[model samples]
Target: MELSFQTVLSQVMLGLNNGVFYAILSLGLAVIFGLLNIVNFVHGALYMLGAYVALLGYTMLGPLLGKPDFHLNYWVALIVAPLVVGLLGIGVERTMLRRLRKFDHLYGLLLTFGLALIIQGVFTNYFNVSGDAYDGKPESLEGAVNLGFMLFPKYRLWVIGISLLVCFATWFVIERTKLGSYLRAGTENPELVKAFGVNVPLMITLTYGYGAALAAFAGVLAAPIYSVSPVMGSEMIITVFAVVVIGGMGSIMGSIITGLLLGMVEGFTKVVYAPASSTVIFLIMVVVLLVKPTGLFGKES
Candidate 1:
């Protein structure tokens, strides 16, 4: 079969769309690891919860609010889900993660892993393995635009644009701003930052919340494209982790660039050989590991 230019272009665009989610999720992971120095295994579960919250808000909450005619739309989910999940993240960090901070890192990992399993289990029991569909899209973003080369969905373009914007905003805040400077300084020497009058503990909690919020934001964005399911995060978290590994944890810009690039590579792989699409990113990860164990942008310890 002769491959058409439009087909390839569309696939590339789709890949880029997927990459936005990867970038956001990995960026969250990078932020959390950079500041908190703990691997958050429950991030994917939080991502799943965000989608479920948006789903519930759209289908159940809207009707309960006496507005069945105008159901909760994507915009509402965009705002509410992150706040809800971020608050949940704060609770988790303060109540559980804080106590484990004095112990080995494995304790934190195990605790989060258990939390992920618990979250997934509860949702699975109620929602079952089959996915629930969220059909709400803002009316303003209902159509596709013909870009001469390809007809792209406006919502997708919005997603890509917004994701990039958020990613850059996050980068700028962490790398160039005063608050960001404090965060960087805290990560290196928490005692010193604390001695200088910074509330290091509170900052750590908020950083975790912010990371969770990022995951939730990505979930809300993804709800329109994928079904909201208990296992959705589990399926994607491993890939996002690989993206972090290939990009290097704690490197914000590295996470963003590697994610988008890998997404493009995966999309191109699908165009050339459909079966290898799933493993392409992992293959790249392996090669990167062999060549540079610290990752493309990671600094040597």
Candidate 2:
């Protein structure tokens, strides 16, 4: 197929959309893995749950509190869904993850896997697995802006910009803040951090909650771009896993940058070679592994 500029630009937009999720989800996964050493297989489910919660909010409260237009209060859902999921994370950490601290890493992985299955199943049972388009879109972000060469959706631009901001904020907090120093210390040696009068267990619990919250936040952002469904996260989660592996678990900045870059690459592939887009990320992962076994930014375990 002959490549056209418009085709490439369209692909880039699609890729940026994918990149938003990858960047956010991978960052959350990296944070949890780095600090708590938990794989958090339930992250995808948590993301789906965020969307569901927003829907629930719309169903119950939007009518009573909505503006004159039928906007359905998505902005409120975007804020509240994550908080609800964060609370759930706290409960999971306290009840399940804390108990597995002394077990093998595989145990944590299996446990989280089971949790994912459970959450997904429950959601599928309640909400049709076939998927439903989000009922609401924020009017504040409606319409498209004319770029020099193309018209870009305002929401799409918001996704890309907000994702970048979130990623950078996460990196800054983890890499440059005093709290981050303690977090790193806890990750390296929880016992020592505890000895230093820190509440290590509490910190670990909060970290997981924060990670889960991040995933849920991504879900809220994603509801408008994609349908809200139980299965929405299933495939994307697998792709993000590959992204995390390629970026390296030890480097938050690596995950952020790699996610966006890969998203753009995937989009370009879709434009030029549609058949190869799905596999392009895996191909990149293979190349990275061959060149750097530990991953692009991952530290040696």
Candidate 3:
């Protein structure tokens, strides 16, 4: 099969779209683990919930509300789904995570892992399809836009733009603001931060909620592109963990850049050698671990 420059550009674009999701999801994981010192194994499950929220809102909201003709639209679900999932995250932090702070960090990991399994099991029982169709792409974003080199889906372009915006905004808030300094301080010494009148517990809870919200936001963005299935989260999480590791665990900027670059690498590999596309990132991971176990941008703790 002969490939053109346009074909190559298209794959890069497709990979960029995928990279955007990875960047956002891994960003959430980085924030939670970097700040809270908790290994949030349920991050992927929350991402799954985000997609399901969008799916059910469009398909069943009207019926569930007894207004058969009315339905939740794409724009509303984009906002509502994250809010709903973030609230659930807040609930989890308050009720379950708060109690285990003094215990070993492994407890948090185990608890979240158990919660993830339970959530996946429940959804698996209800959605037993290869994937649930979600026709929620807004009409404005339905067609393809002509780039100078190639035509790209307008919805995908929107996703790349918006996801990038959100990721940068998050990085800015955490890396450059006064509130971020407080969060960092709280993370290092909560009692000291509390002594200065900051409600560290509330801050931690909100941070976790925000991280979960980021995952959900990615889910909403992804619904139109990927199949909404019970196993989607489980499938995506490992790759995301790789992204997080490669970028350096808890790195704010590393996750963003590494994910985009690795996705492009994966895309380009498909062009150069199809079989290596899937393992290229892992191969990179292996090399990075040997070279700098702390990760590319990861600092030694």
Candidate 4:
């Protein structure tokens, strides 16, 4: 089979789209790992929660607010979904995962894993579809744009660009700002930071909230591409975790870059070797682990 330039371009776009989600999800993982040192197995559940929240918002507003548009403003969902999910994260931090910090990382993982099951089960119980129905496409951004060779879906392009912005902005805040310094310092010496008058526990709470917010934001973006569903987060979280491992868990920039690069690689693999596409990320992770163990931009602790 011959591949045209347009075909290659389209495949590249597809890969980038996947990468965008990978980057965002992995970025959240990185943040939680950075401050709290937890693996956050419930992140996927939080992402699913975001989508469900948006779906609920659209539905509730239709009759109550006299708006039956069937689509929440993408920009509005972007803001509201994260805030709602972030608040939930704060609650989780206070109630469920707070005391576990002094325990083994496995405890956090198992706790989150159980939480994931509960969240998914509740959604499945109420929704009856195991996932939210596709809310349908946003009308405002439905067309395609002409690239050099291929016409790219406008929203896919938006996903790539907007996710990149969020990723880098997050990295910049963590790496270059005073808030970041306080965060890193608190992580390194929580007692000292606390003595210095920083509320270390509150910081921890916010950090997890921020990570959940990031996942939710990604979910809102995803609702436009894939249908919202309870299992959506569970489905993609494994691959994203592999992505985090391959990028080195602690590095924000590494996660973003690796996400985009791996996405492109997966896209090309799909076009060139469709059979390998499913397990491609994991296969790469295995090789990376054997070679460096720390990952592409990983450093030893």
* Winner on lDDT (3 vs 4): 3
Residue 81 accuracy (lDDT) in model 4: 93
Tens digits of per-residue lDDT, candidate 2, 142-217, equal 9998876688889988888887898899889889999999998998988999999998888888889989988998
lDDT of each: 0.90, 0.86, 0.88, 0.88
Q: Rank the candidates by lDDT, best first.
A: 1, 3, 4, 2
- Model 2 scores worst on lDDT over the 10 consecutive residues at 63-72
Using lDDT, give the best candidate's number: 1
Q: State TM-scores per candidate.
A: 0.96, 0.94, 0.96, 0.94
| TM-score, cand. 2 vs. native | 0.94
Residue-wise C-alpha lDDT for candidate 4, range 1-301, written one tens digit per residue: 9988778778988998999899999999998998888899999999988887777777766677776765566678889999999999999999989999888988999999999999989988777454456454577678999887788888888888989999999999999999999998987889999999998999999999999999999988888678777788898899998998899987889999999988999998898899999899999999999998989989886
* Model 1 global lDDT (CA atoms, 0 to 1): 0.90
- Evaluate residue 217 in candidate 2 and report its C-alpha lDDT on the 0 to 100 scale: 86
Residue-wise C-alpha lDDT for candidate 3, range 105-184, written one tens digit per residue: 88999999999999999999999659988987889999999898988889999999999999999899888999988987
> Using alpha carbons, what is the TM-score of model 1?
0.96
Which ranges of candidate 1 are over 4 A from the true structure? Answer: 63-70
Q: Between which residue pairs do clashes occur in model 4?
A: 131-229, 131-230, 132-229
